[model samples]
Target: MSDFLSSTLLFLLQASRMTILVSSAGLLIGFFIAVAIVGACLSHIPWLRRIGNLYTFVFRGIPLLVQLMLAYFFLPAAGIHVPAWVAAVVAISLCEGAYIGEILRGGFLGIPRGQIEACQMLGLPRLDVLFRVEIPQALKLTAPSLINEAILLIKASSLVSVVGVTEITRTAQNIASSTFRPLEAYAAAGLMYLVICGALALAGHYAERRLART
Candidate 1:
């Protein structure tokens, strides 16, 4: 019994590594896409703002599962031919980018107009003001929310199994099928997710404290 549990843990841990890798990649890529989205949304050009809003609307409106299926199945039909991992990451990035974009937009909006006026009065370049002052403050303001979004992303990554990426939930299913221990297998998977998310929460808290001090 002890050996069985240990082996199952090891197997699930292996699969969890894939989960971490994919989720981290998705979040990192999504964050950059989100920055772009926020820029478009906040642009002076009307069409650019509309395009950003449209992107956020479409991605946020569509179900992530549908998005994943479309990426995995429809893309090949359209001659894109991306690998499963690539498809999963792309879908996750797009979906999460929409949400993170909104979060960042909120953060930007929350910044004081006085700060912008001060920068302008000081003859600071627009780009310098935006990159050095606005973006940094926005990021600091949104760090907690972004951390929460990351945790949610990690949980949502279980859905990647449909794209043939063998993450934790899929590994649990396999273990259950072979060992006939569905409860144990799933419980272990749940525990793994808890550990990962808990650790992330702790790290986020530490970062938030550091940001606060700065």
Candidate 2:
């Protein structure tokens, strides 16, 4: 309730948008890439399956912080420089893409082979079968895991500050340093994250209920 806490809240509220933006952007990128990854994993082609497995292993095997550091620090040496914002988003996207691919793969595999076989026998085009039947069902089955990953990404975005993209956590750090009130600044930051993630969870629950009714 102090004036300092009030101003700190204002600063974090403004910067929190960056957290949402980065997380949303990352997730969008991940979704698109994951489609490809899932395809690669499911491919009858041996090379594609191996490549997809390798990519997923590498990304999921490494910690995200390491990925962000490599994107920002090491890529320049390889002459693939990007802005800090781009680096942060790319790191999150690639990392989350790996996990999302696995989640979707599970969904795909969970679907009985009879369904795919039936679609094939029904004269449906391969693409049509995939888009209309398999992918849709896979997504529905894995919706909860997808939502959970999204929430995790929002919190993980706090690490983007290390690459110089000022998000809510970075804003809190700044206020904590300047005001010498680490407890208040960090507490506010945690509450903001909790609110955002809680809202997402509630929304996901509602979606699942609606899906069940259908």
Candidate 2 Cα errors over 4 Å, as ranges = 78-81
Query: Whose TM-score is greatest here?
Result: 1
For residues 1-214, could you state the per-residue lDDT of candidate 1 as single tens digits? Answer: 8898899899999999989998999999998999899999999999999999999999999999999998899779988987798899999999999999999999999999999999999999988998999888998999999999999999999999988999999999999999999999999999999999999999999999998898
Give the distance in Å from residue 47's predicted Cα in candidate 2 to where it truly belongs: 1.0
The C-alpha TM-scores of every prediction are 0.95, 0.94
Ten-residue stretch with the least lDDT total in model 2? 205-214
Ten-residue region with minimum lDDT total, candidate 1: 74-83
In the range 100-213, model 2's lDDT, one tens digit per residue, is: 999999999989899999988899998898889888888889989988998999888999999899899999998889888899999999999999999999998888777667
Go through the candidates in order and give each one's C-alpha lDDT.
Answer: 0.94, 0.90
Clashing pairs in 2: none
Q: The CA-based lDDT of model 2 is what?
A: 0.90
